[model samples]
Target: MADYLDFVGDPGRDDVEGWLYPTDAHLMSVVNDLQVDRGFRGDVLEIGAYKGKSAILLGFFPEAGESLTVCDIFDSGAPVSDGNARENTAFYPGLLQTDFEKNYLRFHDRLPRVHVGPSEELGEIVAPGSCRLVHIDGGHTYEVARADMETARRALGPAGIVVVDDWSSAHIPGVAMALWERYLTGELIPLAFTKGKFYATWDPAGLTAGEVADAVATRPGIEASGTVRLGRYAAAGVTMTPGDWQRYNAGLRAVYSKLYADGGASAPQRVGF
Candidate 1:
């Protein structure tokens, strides 16, 4: 665990709430990539905003006019009738099992929308192509993740980035497996899975038939909510605002660069949420 944490960068950061909160490292990477690589400057859509940690990170990017939309099934929103649902409830009990209300209040006026409901439900509320980045941190089940991914895909802009949390993590092996199998065929590919979170991108021009066939061959009948093409302006690097760069040490960069090094379009298997 220590090695994993070290390899992924520190799990402890004052800016980030805690383990319960999504790490800023992933969002930081996304912001830097979008600004420098894709020239994207738009709203960020976060599917799950437990304690608003990850949303905070996205909120801090240099781009002006870029807002954030938060979606979550807070405080018993998900009915716990079956075994899996009960397990989910147990895992994230009673409003994120944290100070979600306080966190919600913390970002009350900061972001654009504080959507509360299931991913599918909230998906309808978001306008198509309104999101430049979709962060999926909702449910871990295959059905739920797939639905969330589809919604994010539809909501994202042409050169948008879709980030899926816990994609390559042991905490939810089923989600990771489903993501990998689907990725093999889709235009979306795994970018980075730092700190138990996985990032994927959509290139409107990148989708291919061969990849889809391969994905289908590996996992048959697994349908995606939607698919998009991979676009140009491909950019991946580590560039932070001067202040942020100084605050975060070189050790963090070394670790992140290594983690994101061989993490191109290939499916990852060693990630544990």
Candidate 2:
């Protein structure tokens, strides 16, 4: 209750522009807390921050000594290869770095170290094995996702965590292909799977993987993330708690209801979509 859930679970944060499934953030908070409880200290890294919804959630932790770094192309004309121009154009239209900074400053006084260019440049931007956790949510294409994963591999410290968003999403098979390659090669070990993210780590003995499942399984907002056989590895299947499901819908309804009651510009198509 003293962590990210209190902040991100607040309905007020919905005003921030971005997509972050509440459970993904919840799982992250629980696992990160466990790591911190076990006396691990390192920086945090995030790739492809849209407008700082997830970034602010990450900002909740990181004491004076610890740091957080965010990377995004953010209207910077970062090149897209393998026919991803269409994807970029459709997904991020008129996204500005200032917009993200504004949203972040709403929650925190100062911003994390921001990298406003190709995520591949993270190799030079962050020192090797300095990050306790890395979230890979940048490009969706195979090449870019692969490059981001490589950067994550290098950036993670001992018992570090890697979270790849949009893994196994149908629209972006390239993201799936990139992460799956790591799973197959036995480099990144699977810890948990969620609707919008894939959680893993380089813990070769499944120690961190089992700990992640055990940590979040009994947490308030997450379902029982029991261990399940995922290929050659044992991991957990993550989902929203029943309370979270109802709260999510109720939150949407409340937002739209207030919007229309105030005569907002957009018409209400569906109350909860």
Candidate 3:
């Protein structure tokens, strides 16, 4: 986190900004920092790309040879027949409106390869053991998230980094819990856990999620409310067990409930396995 780089506007800045999609600042910071620090030489992938906000951020990295892949259904509300589609569109209506093709072309040469389909269908598109960084922002439901994580894991290389969003949101927690109960419990040590983000580095050595919980518990100012920056570009190590993840989730739920009771937003629906 020491060497921080300020984001500079690219040619497509204005056009990409007009879209309705919102990119996570923390994630943006993480990507930029990684590129600045790591100099992105490996492939980049994002599970849920809405109008390519993150894709654009990924493009900003000064990585010359890296290939960027974007996966999305691109149905818009037009095929909003299912309850899930309806709900998805309710939150994001411009899925179809935003000219993804044209908007993507804003990057012109840097435009990433867009995989048009569901996560499962698009999973195999990315070759196994080829990616250096994978961002999971696709379906919030558990099953979808789990599948997406599996796909990302397949594509991820030994030193690859996996970033999962909506850690605090209920809908996304299914994926969160599954990863915790499984890998976090067994090994796959957590590198960092932000307020609403879970970052785990793939390590052969089995590290428990409790180890991560312990790390968080000892952070300088985490006891205070709101998301605290646990680690900058530097990786923060954590370990946790199955029991630890459960207890952590319970504590998070309680905290979230209190926040909502005070008129704050409730956590998003957790992904269902």
Best by TM-score: 2
Could you give the candidate ranking by lDDT, starting with the highest?
2, 3, 1
Q: Model 3, which residues run further than 4 Å from truth?
A: 1-41, 76-83, 107-110, 204-273
What TM-score does prediction 2 earn? 0.89
Tell how far residue 176 is off in model 3, in angstroms.
2.6
lDDT of 1 by residue, 60-135 (tens): 4435666777777666455522644765556644556246545544544444467776778865678888777787
lDDT of 2 by residue, 1-273 (tens): 354456555554456656676787788888778878887778999998998888988887685688999999888887767466787788778889999999989878999999888887889979998988899999898888988898999999888889999897799898999998988987778888887888898866434666777787668778754678868888788887777778877877676677788676563322221
- For model 2, the superposed segments whose C-alpha errors exceed 4 Å read 1-4, 10-13, 205-207, 256-273
lDDT score for candidate 3 against the true structure:
0.55
lDDT by residue for model 3 (1-273), tens: 111111211111233432111123333344345434544346878887776655666555435676778877776322322544755766656566256666666655546787777778765578887777788877776677777778877887755667787766664466676565546444454556544566776644322233333444543223212233332323343333345335445654665566589677745332111
Computed on alpha carbons, the lDDT of every model, listed in order, comes to 0.54, 0.80, 0.55
Alpha-carbon deviation at 34 in model 3, angstroms? 5.1
Q: CA lDDT of 42 in candidate 1?
A: 61
What is the TM-score (0 to 1) of candidate 3?
0.61
From the highest TM-score down, the ranking of the candidates is: 2, 1, 3
